[model samples]
Target: MPAWTDRALLCLLLAAPAGLFLGCSEGTGAEDVGIVCDPGEGQMCTCASGLGSVAWCRIDGTGFLPCECEAGDEGFGGETAGDGDGDGDGDTGDGDGDGDTGDGDGETGDGDTGDGDADTGDGDGDGDPILDQACYPGPNDDYSVCFPIVVPAPLPAGYDYPAPYQGNPNYRAPVRYLDLDAIDQSAQVAANFTLDEFAQSWKGRYAVLQPHAVAYVQDLRDVVGPISVNSGYRPPAYNAMVGGAGSSRHIYGDGFDLDPIEVPLATLEAACSNNAGFLVEYESHVHCDWRNVDVDVGFFGLPNGDAPNELPLLAASLEQDPHTGHWSAPASGFDEGEPVRRWTAFAADDRVLTQARGRTFEAPPETAYVEVLVGARMRLVGEPLSRRE
Candidate 1:
């Protein structure tokens, strides 16, 4: 009825959406005034002695309804439920009644069978839940039961000896040199073999075991019950001392001369033909290495249980963009809906330099190599890239 109320109603009519009313009022009392609003619109306001609450516009678009505070609001209308015992039973007191079970003993009130044990059902009488078998701590603190190969720092004395071994321009030493002193010889590197079994007996202090090579041996073990590692890593100097080939895979840390314990030598050699990149048959043992095989991006960090063919294939290749000089990893062989690319750059010393979530990466200065992992099942290591100036 007031002049200001008429103006308010006119404003609301202009602002209301299609099919919405413009004006509303209470009964014809002296204090009653016209209110303008859009139906179903909400606004925040003070209520219940200045507590925050929300008021919604009436369906008729006339006035704002009274503010209603939520049930949990302090000093508001609704009653706050008491903090019951967290036993998850439907009670709210110390006793096992049907009411709210406040923090009480581990009785029926707490959803326990009065056994004082929580509902974890671990069976150990402790309330803790049992972890998955896969989550149990392993010898290597990794998913695999095998221990990780340790590569010691500060190259040992006489590591690059015999001058010619290091003087050859084409000669490249093993990327990873195991520190026998730091390794647990008794620790399992596979199901049957120990780290000590792989150490170079000539030095007894340093060794190498390429993960893929180790994986190959494990695959052989799966086919045959168990195998023996007669020879594993051989340092360049040791290789020469033992009349090993100048380019022997042992110097690279991937070669192994294995003898099957349960199967015939011929059967073990046959298995190596399918699993190894190269194999040489001898009267006593069969020599195998992954030197000629393409990198198995998926097999590097995984547990050594599955055969090479059973593992996922991630045939990724690194290419440099001539225009931008950035490296991009394009890959295939992943299962449907399974591609999640991650790129990592490593320095010459095997230190991680940087990582990218995408397929393309801008190599940092002094980047030695790039690797790409697709999901958790596939991985590919790119060929060593030329160092950037």
Candidate 2:
């Protein structure tokens, strides 16, 4: 191999841990899960609802589902399998109406708030662990306990999923997970999809966290209408072809495609440019992502690279709702009624920080953000949808 190739190889090896430590690259599913989840091209996946319910074992498979949790069942983010008949069909569940209980802080789904168990199948009586050895995910990562808190991603042992992506102790400095589940899935995300969640193992460990792309969509859509994910979560092989950065954030483990209806691309870029400081941010919609830096910054411009000191735009908080009316943003930032000032693009989760050039962006695939907010508004789900609406 050439010297550069050798150097690149070294970077992959060195960066692997760095990426993990920086709060990226956690993978999907537990090796214990006997199912394979294949979220097709540009798709991400999570497990069945009841499987992750408080003190339950979730069956894993490639499919879309809302883990069925009772009014108080808790979850540990482990995909569970529910069979009402106990026939291994992976179907059949307890008719508890508490919405997606798998995202809660309790481990047993009993709504007990105690450190619960994850082994819903070990025959340890109720399969509820005593919440012992339970440590919360640190700061700068997902603010939820239901996400990747980093458990050392060891290299894969044969064909199994890699380990959970661990973050850099130096920068991400370990912190306590706020909610027991570690994830705040309750945010009012977009129209169709709940916040897009992913389970990936990097360096050889499993971590449950949100993709930057999804986060970006959720944020932008909060002010706009439906923000579709034109693209999301690509395997390493695919990211290279898309022309990710030298330190491609995707390979480092998080990038996305966002489509917000209200904010113009320039305005979206400017607002998100400074938010990448949250290591959990994903980038790569039509245009976004943070540069690996210690400082902070932001910027805005057209997809073609034209930006003025002030641009026109508007943004809505989760407080409003698409169900009630269309989302809107500030129009005073740009010249009155200038078509060019419309929000044409945006960055994914953590990208768009420090305002770096040379990134990929695109339009959305769906306009279901309105429905997503509506779902939250009804308080049918565990998250505080009212805040998002």
lDDT of prediction 1: 0.46
Error of 2 at 299 (Å): 29
In order, what lDDT does every prediction score? 0.46, 0.27
Candidate 2 lDDT for residue 102:
30
lDDT of 1 by residue, 46-99 (tens): 333544333334333433333333333212111122122333232221223332
251, model 1: CA deviation in Å? 1.2
lDDT of 2 by residue, 1-389 (tens): 01111101110001132221111122334232433332110111112343322221122222212222332342222223333222222222222312222322212243332112332222111222211121112222232322323222242232122221232211121121112134444432223444333222221132222233344444554545555555443333444455532233333223444445666554554455555522221223343333232210000000111112221122223222235432322222111111111122222342222211211112232222221111011111111223345
The numbered model that scores best in lDDT is 1
**Maximum-TM-score candidate:** 1
Worst 10 residues of 1 by lDDT: 127-136
Clashes of each: 14, 99
